[model samples]
Target: MSNTASLKKEYAERIVPALKSQFHYSSSMQVPVLKKIVINQGMGIAVADKKLIEIAINEITAITGQKAVATISRKDISNFKLRKKMPIGVMVTLRHEKMYEFLERLVRVALPRIRDFKGIESRFDGRGSYTLGIQEQIIFPEINIDSIT
Candidate 1:
């Protein structure tokens, strides 16, 4: 099957239902197919907690089970004032059909499980791009203090 068709099928048959069932939200959750995922390690985080950047990378890698590299988007970085900490953002491209499947699982199972969770707030960049803030990262099934080395 063509990638596009597979993506459509995946979205329609799998992702849509999962979102509704798991998140209590519709399949039309409205995530655009990402061309790339960028992890904007903002200066705020860079200065406040240098290790946090790595922590985000490690956590994303573990949760997504994908090799996600951390990079600085200068545009994202420049938006911040140097004196204050910047919020670090992770961007992942979802153009591949497989990404839809991963996104489905992540949104449905992994994300909502976070403790003290609230709905995700998204801002569409209007260039087929959106930015979302995940208030905190807790309740991930893989996390266990005892399990950590």
Candidate 2:
């Protein structure tokens, strides 16, 4: 949904060299690289309105240019009346070019669109993985703003 530019180019052209020197890496190959990007959304409202999942899947597919799949519940929950295999969420895992392309749009466009956004907090899981939560999908320009209610 962005220009033809890619995050991979920026990483190789600028970030890689900077990190290579900052960490004193003997070779560029030693630098750690991203393998994939996982975008997920939990739709609790789906419990009452099954059509919401289909709409979400359409929006996510439009944004990521990939098919989104529903995530099913593993077990039943009595209080919420949740049943096993109920579609409770949606997720899409992007790899290679799509991952980098999404990252490019996320960094260059979506994040900046947040109102009053100063910066992002950096938190990496113990395994060198990171996670970030964005409350609204409207930040993405690819989604049709009018379609969301």
Candidate 3:
């Protein structure tokens, strides 16, 4: 089995029981689990150059191993010169195996490469969700540096 599958199995067998015992939970379903990972990038400058959106799409695809879908503006804004249905951003939603694999790489590899890194903050909303923001896409080892623009 792949590393991610085995890691998931280990979590189910070891972590789940510990969590249940610690939290006084009755069912295993009460344990928190990673649901999905969403990567998003706004293409505001794409308004000036349409090719920027395509480049953003390619970069997102290379990072996530999935095609990104364009996000459209819902309302027209005269001040920003925005129109309805304009391609404003790109995003990829990763779930299941892909999500786990990405999480594994993010935790084990990419995060450590950040200069002067201490540790991730242990903050979360009331809901069982966490969000992390990355400043540069180059941190991930998967992307070929020569190809990036």
Best by lDDT: 2
Report the number of the highest-TM-score candidate.
2
lDDT of 3 by residue, 12-39 (tens): 9999999999999999998888889999
- Which candidate do you rate higher for lDDT, 1 or 3? 3
For residues 37-84, what per-residue lDDT tens digits would candidate 2 score against the true structure? 999999987988899999989989988989999999999997888999
Ten contiguous residues with the weakest lDDT in model 3: 43-52
lDDT of 2: 0.89
Q: Which stretches of candidate 1 lie over 4 Å from their true place?
A: 1-43, 48-50, 73-94, 114-123, 145-149
lDDT of 1 at 12: 73
**Ordered list by lDDT, greatest first:** 2, 3, 1
RMSD of each: 8.2, 1.9, 1.5
lDDT of each: 0.55, 0.89, 0.86
Residue 23 CA displacement from its true place in model 1, Å: 25
As a TM-score, model 2 comes out at 0.93
TM-score, each model?
A: 0.49, 0.93, 0.90
Error of 3 at 76 (Å): 1.1
Q: List the residue pairs that clash in candidate 1.
A: 36-93, 37-91, 37-92, 37-93, 38-91, 44-85, 44-86
